[model samples]
Target: MRQTARPAHPHLLASPAFEELLGGGGGPATMSALRASERSWRLLVVRAVLDSAGSAPAGPLPPPADAWRLLARARTVAEEAVEELLAYPAVGVWAAHTLRRLRGTAEDEAPLWVHTGHLHAIAASAAVRAGLEFRTAVPVRRGWAVLPALGAMRVPEASEPSEWAVAEVVARADGVRVAGRGLAGPDWHPLTELRADGCTLLLDDSDPYRTLRTPAAAEPLDHAAEWQRLFGEAWEILCDTGTGVGSDTGTGTGSGTEEARALAAGLVSLVPRPRAERFRPHSASSGDAYGAALASVPDDGEQLASTLVHEFQHNKLSAFMHLFTLYADQGAARLYYAPWRDDPRPLGGLLQGVYAFFGVTGFWRRRGHHALGQFEFALWRSQTAYALRAIGGADGLTDLGERLVAELARRLEPLLDEPVGARARSAAELAAADHRATWRAHHLRPDPGAVRAHAEAWADGRPMPAAPSAFGLASDGSTIVPCAPARGFDTRAVLLRWLLADPAGFDGLRDDPGAVVSGARPEDVDLVTGRTAEALRAFRARVLGGDGDPETWVGLGLAARAEGDAAGEGLLARPHLAMAVHSELDGRADPLELGRALAVADGDSL
Candidate 1:
């Protein structure tokens, strides 16, 4: 008799399928498989957590093996319910955090048992979902016992308070009870789901492991209805089949419908972050959390749609990285300047950013005729292309990474040629250049010997020597550079946005720059609004008077370049060099004259 062939144990992407994902063309099936792979990885991590728990110092928490046994028993009762519990994003985050603690790579933020005891809660949830009769003890944190995918229950008052309390979970076909109280009562907060069309998102704000940050004081989500409506509209935008807002200049592939399907499959929930400034969108995704995107309230449906797409792209790529080693050890420590980030990023991080922004580009490309859409499309397309070039030339890519980068480049090439309006294009260029120069100023230092040599020439009344060939990465003895997030308001960028999105508003700011933009001077408004000559004069004064403002230095270069001053090119391209030479001169030289001399010294014809 012929035997039946066995299928692949865990789903693996074939070469063609992998290439399709790299080119940004994957749907629900693709996402499901990636999630399955992630689930397998989480299981392996869970196994590791169990294996290492025995060697550690014992604590008051329940045994890891007991929790694992309970989970295994629940799986036998109902595999689907067990899988759902394991697949909840918080489970992955918990497992990763616990594994790090077990291996001594992370801090013991909580008792090791508290970390290992989460498995018990997950098991209880699975048992409850499966309608199986079981009893297990779950950790009560802050008087609440959280069951993954279920909800949280407030543990009854104990005789004595401790850092952690063990609550008994009893499940049956009728219902589930925690610490002798039924979940049907008012003490339980069930995970809320926001459903639009066929897509469902858990608007999770209750789980303790919902975020990687230190647990904040949990407040009631008073804005749940607004979030539900916004999510509904955003889902509609991603699923709408209508022609997009602007003229179709893009040759890019894929539609909002496909994106919506894939996104719905890959994105399990949205965890609300702390409220941010009005109209500003903020979001983040972790590799450990495969299906959740932590996001702040967005200004509108369009903003929400783009933010979801941007973060889901990160989640998707993160899943792929779990399955494949894209780059080798040699490239792991090498940092490259990212156009969107102020700090230097490693090769892998650069790839993640390119992939994430590529999704953002596609989102705006569909609406590239609208004013804001045109500006965003132009901005991210240029930035992504710039970063891709860096990735293509960087060392230490495995065969897989090479193909992935090639596919990304191939898809981005046509988008680069797509038409954008003159104003948006100029703003994009200025924004890209500003960020590049600012990052270089903060993170890349010019050679001290070369800087000193050039400074000496200026002091001795000699022609400036040739500019140093290149700058070195600044670091404080660590392999990674020590850099902080970009400090202060980006006044020029804000003005440019206003100039593109709301021309009338931008014009209104011309008279008083500080009216809307904090920390903006009159020259800052003038620079972005085309009063380059006036702005150049103000910037020179600021720099000459010992104002080491990064924005001033960059703005000076932009204004000078617009006025056909070649001298500004050197300062713009090498703000770190300009700052160094200025420091060497002790701020005695005329900023413009120094820029002019440096321009000639760097071989730029003036």
Candidate 2:
């Protein structure tokens, strides 16, 4: 007969911090559910690690026999962490400063780093209690390495040795023990430093990291010392909490590399962004509790620090979710419009996005006071507040989920009230607003009656009074339009999409059939492609009398303008034709601008 599995080790259950984390914000039933989840998680984590079998990333660590034993006995001090993920255990359910509903299913394969990071934490605490420094249960290999974390909150002096001994502490039910060589005096084995004051970028030649970022944009690092320095500086800035870099120093715990430092400081690992993810960051919906922080190189320390904190918060919540369900029914994965996103996300995705960004706002909150990055401050704070308001009490949350969300809102209250500048405020308002409009265009349908009424009113030459749209949206709150955008991220892309969606964009004005060019006017298209000023002016006159569409006229005018003119800029505020702007001058004049110029020059044609 098959044997039944025993409960998790008593050491873990005996820990108050663990009990409090799993049991907080819940009554007896909720706590009971959490306890069951905790036990499941413990078993699942161990089983998952074993399932990986002989993965390379885990190659150099202690033998599976020794490692598995220590892992089973490991104790966690995981009190719902926020803002920062000190080592692995202190990962907050959400950030300390970020408040919002979290959404997503508890159905992803937790990354290896999570189990390792958590175990690392337990081992670290054990060592400190024994009055000895701790090292990683992971050893250095060609592509993978983990170093000792900085002990305590004490800052190290410049001249002092920053390096520490490397160890891989394995655990058994009876006790925990350290395994690995190079445990003597200050050692540089875990990380190979490239530059002084550089965040030691541990060279991961391992297939997992290399393959994970194999895409051209996110291929493994160039292995330059300079690359290491840039990353190191980012860490140093985050460590400077005085500058508002969040509470963690981003140091201590495993090998002294920048990522390890962050992991030690309660962040997940730093994963390279694939080329496509250049503008934004991402985490698995299933939650990669191991903490994969995806980013490109850092040109701005503040932005980088904020990104680190933002993604870190996500990893924390991802882990938290592994222990409990934040929403009521996974089957009811209702999609909603989020203020800062382009596509519709499920309720779970919306919550996760907001939670991550709230922490990001906090990172900037601290820096904004000192750096005076008013715009960044304005944007993040306003956006976060809007998101919190939208999801704070919307629905689908369990009783436990409600309490946690309430606490998050309580923490967010102070952060949300801080002041912001006009430009930032405007952007904050615009982002959500744009998201709603775009969502309506994509997901909402105007009532047929309203549509017919609008048509008749327009034809009658007297428009109906402006009021809310009579859109037929679902009652599940999936159709809630975001309230926060004034503009879009890229007008060019927006215009392209608009043109594709609006049939009239190609058909031209009905009264002015000549408005849109059926085929590219030779001279106008030439003016844009050839950069000929003379051709542009002549081309403008050709389309001038024709009641050509706005796009046609804009193209002519764009080509006629003197060399070096800011193409399409005049259309920035044109609510009707706003989508045509391109990054590089589509050289030809925008027909709208060109047509207007002609109307001013000669009124007889009109």
Candidate 3:
């Protein structure tokens, strides 16, 4: 086996490329750096396996040295094929997961060889692609030998699903065989690709490690044609017909084309996730898997287009992070709040949400001619802007992180002034305010002393106490605390979407909204559909009747604010404080009067 010398210098992103990534898109230079970073991780994993051969636990496969020799021989036959195999998304996932397990940094219960022996399967695939004659033992789980990007072979006669069995992979110039079964038979499953225009992607469904970072349940490929058709439609919306490639105009005929071009260049594989609730597309990406993403089928072409852009933005930032440190290591605390999520996020997670939504903002900005697009553009642009400011002012950011945040803010600030009609603007504001108020009420625990003082004073008919100086984000700071649903705020957001996209359909929901959406209430439908006066009465009634849902308080605040009431600002700004005081009164206080008192006591600083 022949070995090639590794590059002496570490991978780095040039200034221009880094700025391009910050501008909400990526290009060949950025993509190449990410791919190289993934390759480095793969090689690092292989080296770690070799070095730890002595202490690694026993399993069904050959020794680490023997497997390494087999992979080395394949590299000598076809260096490019071997590198490509190493850069495969699942390969990166396996490499990172295995390296963590091997170094004792991660607590994995599986035998060490179960992870290391994936090298043999990768080698076998490379040998087959190179047409090199070779034989090696690969792990078979659940009667299947998954060859990463190549495909999988069903070995029915192998060991039980709970245990790993070693299967012999013998390859020749003609074809490959697993356990004496030839590749020409039905037992061998080859991966398929979806092609449209100039964009091609591996529609990965069979890879064992294809689940990415989480253990996702796989669906049958019977609906493959439907997914392909939806993908083709999404491609039509995302295709770049402007400049040859990497050209994002941000306006007019070719706006978002550069982003589309970038998506095509960097996106290589997609794993189909189970269909999400409401048929909305769900997507996830990992820094370990640079070019790959997992997503459920989107409900429509517009959704598909945005979903792809969102996940690809995550991939771009992840890859960029792989090349450079963004923030110093954060201790174990998920303290920051992300507008898009209900739970408290860590600093790094907040940065990721900002970057991903930056891409989403760009997508809607380009499509702002329609009401749905305008509303989304208005909503996400504001949310993303706030998050950028939060992170920019945050401590622990490296010099590079500060620069990236500044560039992103510079690019996004202009969009804030872009007109999206008053109606769209109003709906966007309501939704954003609702989400913020609901998040605070759900996650931010009021200071107990302030709560008691305010409650006692209100009960005794004295002046209310001042707002709490600080609120605890979680009871336990070490891990992410699970949060209840966003009350009716999420339902209201959905109704707003329906109102913007399908008004007649939304009007039809006035009679019975719960018939359409399971948990949607009449007041929510009325609130989003412009019946503010009517909805205000209903929301006020709900709050006065001791309804403790945070959404009720937020809804009342939104309605009152729409009518320019000063008291509403207190509820919108400090719902956590209001809820604590309300609990002390046992829901007997008047909603507007309570809001007015809180606003007065807080000195209008709320």
- Listed per model in order, the count of residue pairs whose N, CA or C atoms clash below 3 Å is 1, 58, 1
Cα lDDT tens digits for candidate 1, 203-261: 87877778854432223375588888889888888887211211122123556565577
In candidate 3, stretches whose alpha carbon ends up further than 4 angstroms from where it belongs are 1-6, 104-111, 156-163, 215-220, 240-258, 468-482, 486-489, 504-518, 544-546, 563-565, 600-606
- Model 3 RMSD vs true structure: 3.6
How far off is residue 214 in model 1, in Å? 5.4
Write one digit per residue (lDDT tens) for candidate 3, span 84-110.
877888877777777777777765555
Q: If candidate 1 were superposed on the true structure by all CA atoms, what would the RMSD be? A: 4.4
Q: How would you order the candidates by lDDT, starting with the best?
A: 1, 3, 2
Local error of candidate 3 at residue 133 (angstroms): 2.0
Question: Which ranges in model 1 have alpha carbons more than 4 Å from their true place?
Answer: 1-11, 55-58, 155-163, 213-220, 241-251, 330-332, 468-481, 485-491, 502-522, 600-606
Q: What is the C-alpha RMSD of each candidate to the true structure, in Å?
A: 4.4, 15.4, 3.6
Give the Cα lDDT of each candidate: 0.74, 0.39, 0.73
Deviation in angstroms for 419 in model 2? Answer: 2.6
